[model samples]
Every structure is written in C-alpha cells, then in structure tokens.
Target: MDILQFEKQYLRLPSAIDEIHDELFDQKGIRVFVKRDDLIHPIISGNKWRKLREYIQIAQFNGYKHLISFGGAYSNHLYALAFAAKELGLASTGIIRGDELTSQSNLYLSQMESWGMNLKFISRTNYQKKLIPKEIDTTNSMIIAEGGYGKMAIKGVSYITKEINQGNFEHIICPIGTGTTYLGLCESTNNIEVHGILTLNNLKEIESNALEVGIPIQRIYDAYIFGKYAKQPEELVNFCQLFEQKHQIKIEPIYTGRMFYGLYDLIRKDKFKPESNILALHTGGLKS
Candidate 1:
C-alpha cells in the first residue's frame, strides 16, 4: 500500500488553473485566480480523492475486503469512494441519508450500485443516530467517515497551500461542505485568508470541529442552502449553465456552482480591494 506508487499509477490529474490571468480578474474588479484540484485524477480527484487516498491505503494495508462510508443521494464523496474502491479492487458500501428514491436522483446511486457498491438508504434521524453503520465487520473492514474523515483527510488540501505559496495570492475562497478541505487548506498555510462558503445551513457544528483541529478559517459567505443539502435554486441553475458556457467547465449545483456564484456576488458587492490577489479553489465536485 505504497501511497506514492498509487499516486504515480492512478492520481495523475491536470491542473485546471493553468491559464488564468489578470484579465479574467479584471472583469470583476479584483485580482482572482483558481486552484484546479478538479483536474486531479479523473475518478479519484478533487478534495474527495485526496481525503480518501490515505483511508483506502490504510484499508488495503489492513487487508480489508470492504470499505464502508456515508453520504447523501448525490454525494460526491460517495461517488468518488465507489469508483476508487472499485479501481483499487475492494468492495464498497454507501449509507445514504434519505429513504425516498426518486427516478431522477437515483442515477448516480444506480451507477455506484453497478460499480458493485452496496447502497443502503436510511432515515435522516437514523442516519444521524448511526454515524457508523452497525452491520460492518470492523475487525477487517475500514469505515471512512464521510466528508474527509478528520485531520487525515487534509493531505490533498495541503497541495493547494503548496501551490499558493508558489504563486502570489493573499486570500483563498472555497465552498464548505463538511469543512474538511477548508480545515486542511487553513492548517497548511499562513498569511492567507481562508474563506469558507457554507454549502449547508447550520454549520456551527462543522465550524467547531474545524476549530478543534486548529484550522484558522473565516466563514465569509454561505451558499444560502436553498433549503437543505443538495437543494438548488433557479438562480443557481441558471448560473451553472452560464458558467459552463463561458468557462467550458461543468459545475454541479451542489458545491462548485454555489461557490462561484458567491464569489461573483462578493466581487459585485466590492468585498475585496481591486488590487488584492484572491484565489478561488475549484474543489472539483463538478462531476456530481
């Protein structure tokens, strides 16, 4: 389970931020840049890819035949985990949050099932009450906590800090789901303002958890949630379509699209100085 070897063999991804220049930022009257973690490995890419890499390594090292985790119906983490586990020759299971299975929403879940992932849908109350699935054989199996699984999940986020250090940027903005990526980015760097836009409402618990990990972060904006997790607004849908047309990049309404919308709003509101350098993290859940 040499992670280095795994990285070399399966984690070769492009940097999506390659050609961004001042001209792009000038349109918004602020100096803006992007960190393309989205281009990391196609399957095991983005924050989810980095966060799960070590967990997969540990599971394989421990000779686990199965990997179990949690997420919602359209969870990027679940999607990434299913694909990564299949790629690494391991069994995978997803404990989804809701019981209702809509035809439109079950496409990804069906795909995961096709990839040999066992899908279990639980009630929201039951899902929260049961953080770790009870049926799993913990003796030989590894259960990766959803949303980056604490400090160990920050390995991939450290790469963003390294990239920023190599460039000249004062502030970095990214969407906050479980706050794992935000924690990793903040802990791995200094002198840069880390702004997390909450993708869900009621993130006080996540904030406390991130602070406990000693990650300095500022919650500068929130995605308005639209009601709850995975819920989207017409504005967001329109923005997603417009963004893809302009940038030739597809963004899911769940995370990246919301963050981009927030960023644009912040710039429109004159939240940043025109001369300031800002870097927005494309945390890459676009494939949704």
Candidate 2:
C-alpha cells in the first residue's frame, strides 16, 4: 500500500497480523501468531500510533493548535506524534531528554524536526521531574505525557484486548517499555494470561510504570534485557538477525526483539502446554 492510503486508513482501524509457520514452535506444542501492529504505518506504527491517535484527535477537536510532548533522543512517541501532527496540520513540540544533542544528534530526531516538530532539549533530571508532570506551556496546546501513556491512550490500546478477545489465544505477550500497552491490554481482559517482557535494566521502576496504569503484574521477564534500555549488545543483535531471517518479520533490539527472544525462552522451558495458543504483539519501535 502507498504511504498516504495506509496512514489514512490506519487511524480508523487496527493493524493486521501474520501467523508464523516455524516448525520449532509447532514441535514444541505451541502456536504463535503475531499481531502486526508494526505495519500500521511506517512512522506512526504499532503502539505508538495507538497511543497517539486519540490524543491527536482530541487536540484538534478541542481547538488546540499545538501539541507538546516529551521523549528521549530516539523516542518512537515523539517521532510518531511529530508526523501525525503534521498530517493533521497541527503544530507539535518535542521536549527531548538530555541537553547534549546538536541539530544532527541522530536521524530520528532530524526527521522529527524536518516534519515540523520544534525541538526543545532539557536535562534528564528536569525532564523527569518537570516535563513528565506535564508542566509545559499550555497556550492552546495539549500536553502529552511521556511515551503517550496517559489516560487518553488507554482507549486505543484496548483495541488489542478487543481483538484478542475475538481470537482463540490463551495467552497474550508484549514487550514492556513503560507498560502502557500492557495495561491497556490488561484493562480489557480478565482470564487470559498477559506476559510483559522488560527491555530495560530497571525492574522496579518498570514495575512502578506498570502500576501507574493500574495493572498488577503477575510475571514480567527481565532476563533478556541485555544491559540497559537502547543498548544493543552483541547477543541481542545476533539473535534478532537470525530470528528475522527465519520468521521474515522485522524487529529491533529495543522492544519486540527482546519480547520474542523471551517468548522462545519460555517455550523452551515448557512453560506452555500443548493446549495453549499464544499471541505476541509486535509493538513496533524499529524507527527508534
């Protein structure tokens, strides 16, 4: 599909899915289906699009001319909102973490700015304390919480729950960065087991983020975090390369790759019985 056609259609619908025919999973007595939310749109793909769709609509409908949000250097949230805002003809400003970046810090930031997102750099401490509290100037502006995980996004993320409810899957698994999508999925289900895989070194802080969404964690796998957030150690890189080659599904180290790796680990341990059907969400932050 062309970019414009897909973008316009995605705002009104959920992304498609693909079923992998890997014999390893089949021999292990498990069925794996990937919810390809990553293919929703190139820039505003996956959970980022789900998290930002309604916020952007509310911004425009509420008569706001500008949207201000916070994120790190390669945040998918900022990258998505920048392009979505531009598509909707609304102005956007990204309060980026760290005051150490030049105009050419990286390609993601550069694309954000090129798409009409005004960049504002702040120290990490201030970014955590001030901007995270939504203290940005609000003159005709909508203040988006970090990672676009505020209440506004819960509705969109719940779409996953709705889809999963319609499927025969016994368990749902997703990568947990800030736990927004996990919570959204959790809020709409009662019986299905939801597994969240950590992609950062922070277990306690990640738990807190999950709690902020009011989702009680049962099992969160953190063994595959590699080292820290955004750190692409050799193992993770090599694993992603091999997995993509076999599955033909594109994934990055920061999120989906870790989740898939962790999923295979659990399967190898015989954690799921032959009666179990699993759905892994491709949450999509490869652009980051």
Candidate 3:
C-alpha cells in the first residue's frame, strides 16, 4: 500500500477534542479541553503518527524502502514504526540502547520483531552517539531520530494546528520529551500561549532545541517533573488512576499524567488569567 492510501485507511486525522470539567476550572472561569490524539490509532496513536507521517511520505517519494530509527527497549516510537512499516509494505530497523537486551527482552521489543522489524541492540555509549551498526545497510533507508525529534517532525506536528481552530483557544499545552510537539505548536500558532510541561529535567536542552529552530521559548514549566523521566511515583500513579476514573480517558505517568498534573497545578495557582480557554494535548504514552 502507498503512504497516502495507508493514511486514509488506517489513520484518524484531525483527532477529536473533548472538554473536561472541574470545579476548580469553573471557579477560575477557565475552560479546559483535551485534544484526543490518543484516539488516532491503537498502536501508532497520538503524536507518533503525526511525527512519522511526513517521514514516511518523504521515504516513499524518494523511493526509500526501509525506515531506521533509534530508541530504547520499550520505545513507543520503534513499536509504532514497526507496525506502520509492516502495514505499508516497508522494512524497518530499530536501533535499541542497552547491549544486554535482546528482541525477547520485553514484550514490546518482541512485538517489534514479530512485526518484521530488525532489532539491533547496542551499548549505551554508542547509542548516545547514535552509531549505526556496520552490518545494517543504510541504502534506501530513512534514519529517524529518537522520539521523532527533528525539523520534519516539527512540520508534521504543525498540522495539528490546522486541525484545531486557533481562534477558539487562548492557550495550548502539551508534555515535552524531545519538544517536537511543543515546538510544532509554537511554530504554527499565533496569539496562543503554548505551554510545555517538561516530563524530564531537560529545560536547557529543550530551550536549545527551540533556539536552534528560531522558536522563542516561553511558559515552559519545570517544577512538575516528579523526579525524572519514567519515574512513576505513587502520587503520579494515583493521579493517573483518578484521572482515568474521573474522565474515562486513559493516561500514563510518563507523559500525559505529568502534563495533566502540571496543568491542574497551574490552574489552581491561577497561572492563567480568568476565563482563559486552554487546550491540553493528550500525546498518548499509554502503550509506550
């Protein structure tokens, strides 16, 4: 199948927006809505599909038959890429960190292998350097950065703004890992406050990335990164559970959970002006 056909058949573009209710928001005269990017697809859901679609188009356009990317054992990026490549009749390779790990090391890794992805595990040092293996062939392959971070991804993510009515929202917010989604929002939106909640202590890195791309960094919150990336503390876990119970929308501690937690804190603190319409992006880390 071709890339356009695959997108039309499998992907949900312009994902739905749902309004969330809370007494605090009411008290503050603020309206909260969530962009349900998680509903885009089951496996390749959220910003993953948004970030990968452009790369896939570029690959097919240039006659590339393979997609290669770097990630960890349980990387959602790799898992989604494997499934996307399989459905689109393309080859995929996942360059994983941690040399001790194998394809069978975890369910996600094994699943990637099952989807016909070539899993190459490398040492942490080499992974940091993003070294490609000597055995793997790079011809006709598109190398995607870890977490789908790149200018192309920023372009893909900017399409989210096209899906949204910019006039209706006063502020837009999303969780920042590599800052691709955040930067994309910053690039596309005018007269909207783009807020980023750092999932990890990478404020400096995100700022550097923004500056590199000529995006002015503003309203980035660093106080909400519970401890570090993927820490999953009890407070965050409980918050995710209650959030699920309250809204019936699933969220995990790694990304969406922290974002919502931080958003709620900001709301309570009156960080936003009264009567502000805020849109929070649910970037789907549930299966990652």
Q: For this target, which candidate reaches the highest lDDT against the unseen true structure?
A: 3
Candidate 1 per-residue lDDT, tens place, 137-185, comes to 5566777776656666876567667655534777888888888887787
Cα lDDT, model 3, residue 91? 98
Candidate 3 stretches with Cα past 4 Å from truth are none
User: Which parts of model 1 have CA positions greater than 4 angstroms off?
Assistant: 19-24, 27-29, 99-105, 131-134
* Cα lDDT of model 2 by residue, 156-254, tens digit: 787667765545888989998877787777777667788889888767876776677576776678888887887988888888999899989989988
TM-score of predicted model 1?
Answer: 0.87
Alpha-carbon TM-score of each model against the true structure: 0.87, 0.90, 0.98
Superposing all C-alpha atoms, what RMSD in Å does each candidate have to the true structure? 2.8, 3.2, 1.0
How many clashes in each structure?
0, 0, 0
Clashing pairs in 2: none
114-217 in candidate 3: lDDT tens per residue?
99999999999999999999999999999999988999999999889999999999999999999999999999899999999999999999989999999887
* lDDT, residue 90, model 2: 86
Off by over 4 Å in 2: 1-12, 132-137, 165-167, 209-213
